[model samples]
Target: MSLPSPSPFPPPSPSAAFRPPRLLALAGPTAAGKTDASLALAREFDAEIVSVDSALVYRGMDIGTAKPTAQQLAAVPHHLVDIRDPAQPYSAAEFVADATIRVAQIQARGRLALLVGGTMLYFKALFDGLDEMPAADPDVRARLEREAADRGWPALHAELAAVDPRTAARLAPHDSQRIQRALEVYRSAGRPLSEFQQGRPGRGLRPAALLSLEPGNRGWLHERIARRFDAMLQAGFLDEVRALRARGDLHPGLPSMRCVGYRQAWEALDAGWTPAMLRERGIAATRQLAKRQLTWLRSMERRTVACDGPDPVGDLLQAAREVLR
Candidate 1:
């Protein structure tokens, strides 16, 4: 797809004799038009794109992750996308480290760094920085995994809600890795995961302009979610999952597989789900993911521009350019 032309606005003029490192971060729910908005803004500012998406980091998972087309990637350089295999795991800490390096490199060259994607946790990590939480304990992880296997993740989620409701509220019931890690952190550290985050200073990563796109109407977002999933199905999303399954190294429990579409498709394929059921489940899971992303967006302390219109890319970029000014 051809990229939209760069915006009419000029790049932010340097304010002082000295210039601070400034990055642009675009965040929103699925199908909220973040990708296109970032592309337009990146072009306007001559910026390199750095993906903050979790699933997009994995290779061979393009359509399901809604990754940019090859044409678009070639149009604008993007960092931290498709950098990992499905068998490997990635985390917010890793994203912070990598994004810090990328941002610094872009600044050294005097180009803007535009961080874009729907992964809120990575954004939080980059902004406020992670607390020095206790390291993972194998015993705690194993125990929680055993409990999850025996009693289901929902039950464990409930237990976490009782203990660390703040963290539990942010995580979905099916988010096994986070749930397990949260529980492990609490068990090992003798403090709730949320408690550890209290009053931690940022890691001094470059300052960034934050823009969040939220649909004005829930119905509209739901419709978009359904339509996008159908498009993915037409694009052979199931076949992509099947290929991953046949790889013999990747598993459903892997973080990469637990991404919304891939997770549902993996389960559906095993249970002999009908095409209709697969489509329904895929759309529903996407809606849930969007809901979670929106919730995370709301909890952010940084003020954001509300994106509510037929053309959110236009609205978001207009607001983002003002931030640059």
Candidate 2:
């Protein structure tokens, strides 16, 4: 992709000098044109792209993550995209730490840092910072996993209700992972995760601007999602999933495996689902993810720009330049 021309706008004033390094965050739902827009903006600003996506963190999980291709990667440097194995876990705290280092490096090089992704939680972690939650206790998690396997998530839900009713009330009965996490935290820390989050001060990095691209037409967005899934299939998403599965380290319920397309692919493999069924499920899951992204964007009021037209990249760069000015 060709780089867009530099913005004509002047930089921000000196009074804003004490601000943390200016970060351009491009966020939107799946297929809302974040990748293309970030690429263009990075070129225009001489910035490096730091991915805030959870799925893209895992190695050997390419096509479904919609990771940039070798050609595209060569166009501009991208950070934290494929830094971990499928079996290893990466968390929001880790993201913030790594991203902080990357941002500093980008600034030292006299370039800006542009974070781009659809992962709402990742973006939230960067901006609001994570609570100083305790590290996961493997023994506790293993015990919970065993309980879930034996008696199922309802039993876990009941346990959570007894200890942390607030979290239990908020989670669905079938939301095993979150329920388990809540219970684990309550047991280990003697406090609910929500309470911990509330106690934390504003420790997150505030971006210079937050640009969100939301299509007014859901139908159009869904169509784009379907097309993108089809392209992923054509681009070997299934093979990538299969390779990750063969690693014998990834479980379907792990955070990495639970990413939209990955979960669907795992389910298809487990149920002996046909190729057509897998593709259909993947597309549906991606659409749902997009809806969630839209909801997140809508709830964030400040520094948000809604793009409803065809040329979101053009509008996004113009908006970023405006923010810089």
lDDT, each prediction: 0.82, 0.78
TM-score per prediction, in order, is 0.90, 0.85
Q: How well is each residue in 1-325 modelled by candidate 2, as lDDT tens digits?
A: 1223342223356996655455777788888777788889999888899998888898888888888888888899999988998888887779889998998888888788898888776777777677788888888999899999999999889888888787666566766667877888888999887676442323566567677777777888888888999999888887888888887877886878877888888888889999899878788778767876776666553355556675677878777787666
Per-residue lDDT, model 1, residue 69, is 98
**TM-score for predicted model 2 compared with the true structure:** 0.85
lDDT of 1 by residue, 1-325 (tens): 1122343223345774255436777788998777888899888889899999999999999999989999999999999999999998887778888999999898888898888889888887887788777876778888888899899999999999999999999888988878888888888988899886653445445355566777767888898888889999999999999999999999876889989999999999999999999998889889988999988887775536555665677776677666666
State residue 178's C-alpha deviation in candidate 1, in Å: 2.3
Among all windows of ten consecutive residues in candidate 2, which has the lowest summed lDDT? 1-10
